[model samples]
Target: MTVTTDTARLPLLLTTLLLPTVARLWPAIGATADAEGWPAAKTLATLLEHEVAERASRRIQRHLIEARLPSGKTLDTFDFAAVPMVSRARIAALAEGDSWLAKGTNILCFGPPGVGKTHLSSALGHALIDAGYRVLFTRTTDLVQHLQTARQELKLASAIEKLDKYHLLVLDDLSYVQKSQAETSVLFELISARYERRSLFITANQPFGAWDSVFPDPAMTVAAIDRLVHHAIILEMNTDSYRRKSAQARAVTSDPGTTAHPN
Candidate 1:
């Protein structure tokens, strides 16, 4: 078959317009359309649809990479049965919707270590990313240190402003941040800057009563807690550690002589 000059030039024009997916796929789509005796409008619509779907997929992949969520931590992988206090339905609703995020609502998970706070937070991050929302997951101590450096360099406001791009910021292990003026000051600044503007999801091992250990000053502690819980969904996961339960189950399974009793 002889190729027409206009048909050959179409791909180059599409590519120049930054429609790479459409450019690459139009040839096959055009062939199918021609075989089916479809109208020109239908062929163009089909090509555009393929390009839109491909762009959406690429956007999600980029968001997932930028999220930095822990691998294998997703809603499906989280054991909801282990933490009965936390409602799976509520978590699912939060994951599937963006209304709360639009309102700049926060999510605070308080519990002892190994009770799935981090897992749940990371899972929510993964779900939100899939739902086309940008999320960034980082340790509280690490982000605080970065912000402190920015403060010292007189770029703290700019540094915090850059984080405004993400719809949700997941701060894991909030209890691990050192109780120092420098550290707590930057953290408080971040909370204040994002207050009622961008959402924050925090996982902490301590309750609000004990947050004095993290903030140092009583006034600072109260102010930070006030801002966080002002429009927040508090998740109390005071259940037994999942790690301990898994270890116990593994021990029982490994010992052939041990008989496991039904709970």
Candidate 2:
């Protein structure tokens, strides 16, 4: 339908002039308004909302790509039943809206190897990315080495400043870092710099006492723990290895070379 009258053409003209960037939407907006008999106000509102959502989706995709998050993990795919002690409700809230990271609250996940710590952390991070939060994932040793290199070049502060851009920094397998002053010093500096400004989501195979093996010096170890636990959420993953359990189930379900078990 043609807008022959000046009264009807005024709103459409204004919409195009105001949203020149989304001029492609003008045709659909006019078509929708004509077909649905919608008021200009309603049509403009709907098209504007659609434009905002599309832009948000594009931004989220970019964040995910840059995040380098562990793939193929989400709350839906996690076997919460296997780990009964974990608080599913709490995790869901944090992933969706807790915004604990916004207040510089750290998250510490402690458990033996294969207990799904990485999986849980990665899944939560994926959720946060979808929720418009920036996340960066790195292994404990790699990030420490990177920091140490930055220190060598006298660019440690600059490196840390770059990292501060992310809302949450996920360090996987903190127990693997060797007890070396060079490594620990840089790591400590990172923690100290972001102490009350950014968040850390860390996974460790060892408990707090065992962390001394990673830090060596008792004072530095204590300081690291203090900063981490202050205003933090501690998740103790005490369950057995999910990978082991899955392997055991597969063995039981598999055939044993045509041999039948006696009933």
Candidate 3:
């Protein structure tokens, strides 16, 4: 097929205007427009729709990369059957993030180790990111250490403020943070800063009553708990450890001499 003069110039004109998608797809779009006898407005609308979709796709990809969530931890992969107490419908609704995140509502997950708190939190982070909300996932101790370093350099406030861009911050293993004034002070400041402003999704092995070990100071512990629980959704997962159960199942499966009896 011979290229028309106007068609040959269209790609250059579109590229000059910084519309890369339109420039790239103009040939196919032109072919479709001619075959379908589309009006000028329809052809232009088709080009714009593709451009908008391409930009949205690129933005989502960038947000996912910055989120830093763990791999293979999505809502589909989570075993809701194992954790009967947590409602699958509730989780799916929360993942949409329209009601809670917009109101700066926090999510607190309390449980013993290996009960899938980390898994659930990371899964939510992944979902929230896919839903077009910016998210950040970090271990409590690691983030505290970074904040401590920032404080030492007199940049703590700036560092904390930088995190405001994230709609949801996922802090995994809050109990692992050391109980020291330096560590706890910075952690408290972070919680205080984000209180009623941005959302936090936290997974902690310790309950509120035992948080003195985390904050060291009684007043700070109470204050932190007050802010977190004020407008929060609390999920208590007190079941047996998933890892322990998996280990036991593997052991039983490996023992060939074990026989199955009729019920």
TM-score of each: 0.94, 0.86, 0.92
lDDT of each: 0.91, 0.85, 0.90
Worst lDDT 10-window in candidate 2: 14-23
The order of the candidates by TM-score, greatest first, is 1, 3, 2
**Candidate 3, overall lDDT?**
0.90
Q: Can you tell me which runs of candidate 2 are displaced by over 4 Å?
A: 1-21, 256-263
State how far residue 29 of model 2 sits from its true place (Å).
2.8
lDDT of candidate 1 over 68-88, digit per residue (tens): 999999999999999999999
Which residue pairs in candidate 3 have backbone atoms (N, alpha carbon, C) closer than 3 angstroms, thus clashing?
none
Please report the candidate that would top lDDT against the real structure: 1
Clash counts for the predictions, in order: 0, 0, 0
Steric clash count of candidate 3 = 0
- The lowest-lDDT stretch of 10 consecutive residues in candidate 3 is 3-12
In the range 1-263, model 3's lDDT, one tens digit per residue, is 98656666876888889899998887899899999999999999999999999998998889989989888988898888778899999999999999799889999999999889989998998888878899999999889989999999999999999999999999999887768636668889999999999999999998888778888589999999999999999998899998899998998989968987999
